[model samples]
Target: MKIFLTGLGFVGSKLVTHLIQSPENQLRVVSRSPSATLPAGVHFEQVDSLEKVINWPTLIGDSQVVIHTAARVHVMNDSCDDPLEEYRKVNVRGTLALAEAAAAVGVKRFVFVSSIKVNGEETFPETPYKADDVPAPRDPYGISKLEAEQALQALSSSSGMEVVIVRPVLVYGPRVRANFYNMMNWLFKGVPLPLGAINNKRSLVSIYNLVDFIGVCAKHPRAANQTFLISDGQDLSTTELLQKMGRALGVSVRLLPVPVSMLKLTASIVGKSGISQRLCGFLQVDIEKNRRLLDWVPVCSVEEGLARTAQDFLTGRRA
Candidate 1:
């Protein structure tokens, strides 16, 4: 039951905390962040960088499953000279190298944490992105993830290494970074947010549930060579989402009911269109395949997930 895990970010760290609780699981984690804390008894290995090649064959030895969560994360309003090339270096090529070496060293399964953006960034109301929908990545980061999934599938076929791809939407939990964390801070500090009138629906997965699904995908025989779209199975509008966060944080929302069209216009003028799109976009995912094929259900409800995150934020348990 030896498992090799890469990336010690919010998602990977949570996965470790969950997996190490099982006595039957032997954990080996590899990451460039040597400063990351791990539970006692988990073996750790350091690597130089994701984009750089290492002796992965030696590093992944005797592990039955590998969960890869490392990559160059998506940057909003990217100013890079060549964002696609930069993302492909780490997300695509780096992943292929790791999977190839894992296969060489007899790793049985590779679980890839992908993004819902691979099915395009938006969906019409009541029409969620399906598990088998054609990939239509709108940005460089999404494109890179899609490419990595393709490469992994080919390697899985030729090398007999099982590959499971899980595409999750807007994962939220303790120690979340980037915009989600920023939104939480605003809610905590009682900032006047202009998202009250946004009528867009978004599907979100809790970190606890996502890690649980990853564990299931790692071991489930039916998960081999399949892609899963997962969420809390509850979709919420932007206004409702902020309201819930406000309640969780024990604060009243100073949410301004601004017009969505005006907000988008202002964002366009200021070159922050991405933020506006996220605030007023419709992105829902259908997790029917996750239930039908894997018989999996989310481990926690959204209310519980938000409550845990709120507790951590108030107490400074994780950052």
Candidate 2:
């Protein structure tokens, strides 16, 4: 497969690296600014516009597959006046523009990396989000991703391009940042945490597993025109996650059995209600379809993945 990879951020960069390692595959990365740390001997095109794909046909020349993973993801303190519009500009419009260009260039499969938030912010323990669930995006980012998914489906129908959408829950692995990274830091340092009582179930995929699934979708026959919700096939509660993380970090876990109601109340007062929800909410995915349709199971167990991430963090800390 002559694959054209986009984004080159967290997921994209890891996906591209994984795909290119196969001797049977040919991969070319497209980025607005090339990373100096990309694997040696990798071929990538540096351009001025990743969002618009300026001169797209020539830029994407002769590629048979495109794995698009770019987006304006969640921001901490966004300064934008209309966050939804900003998100749409990159996630919806830019994705469609690139998809059309890829179709025009005769690309056969376009795998899009979407988020679990498209289904909603929370799920009941009895009702894990499936790929076919009606989207209930609770935030601007989720809404934009849902819009982009819809647009891609419409484009695929009209242009005869095979579109595979993969919606992954919180992705964590070696070098993961943001909340997962902070979780590690807190656990490793034995920071006082009120998360012990949080019994909410959340699904997380290792970057290894996510990249593996993306590679499968890029070429699997049944994956064409299909959407998949993926995870490690294991769900963890906030308390369990912290405990496991402490073990991985070789630290004794210290947690306060703070009541959920008190946590939410305090967070709301401090304008961090969203943080409370994240720490004490339910979000899980049904990956039965991924297994039944594609015969895909996560390549790495959650324990192994967490161990690797913890190892990397420790190595970095020591260095």
In order, candidate lDDTs are 0.91, 0.89
What total of clashing residue pairs does each candidate reach? 0, 0
* Worst 10-residue lDDT window, candidate 2: 47-56
Candidate 2 lDDT for residue 189: 85
Across residues 60-135, which tens digit of lDDT does each residue of candidate 2 receive? 7888999988788878667899999999988999898899999998999999999888999898876799999888
> What lDDT tens digits, residue by residue, belong to model 1 across residues 59-167?
8889999999988988976799999999999999999999999999989999999999899999998899999999999999999999999999999999999999999
TM-score of every candidate relative to the true structure: 0.96, 0.97
Write down the RMSD of candidate 1 (Cα, Å). Answer: 1.6
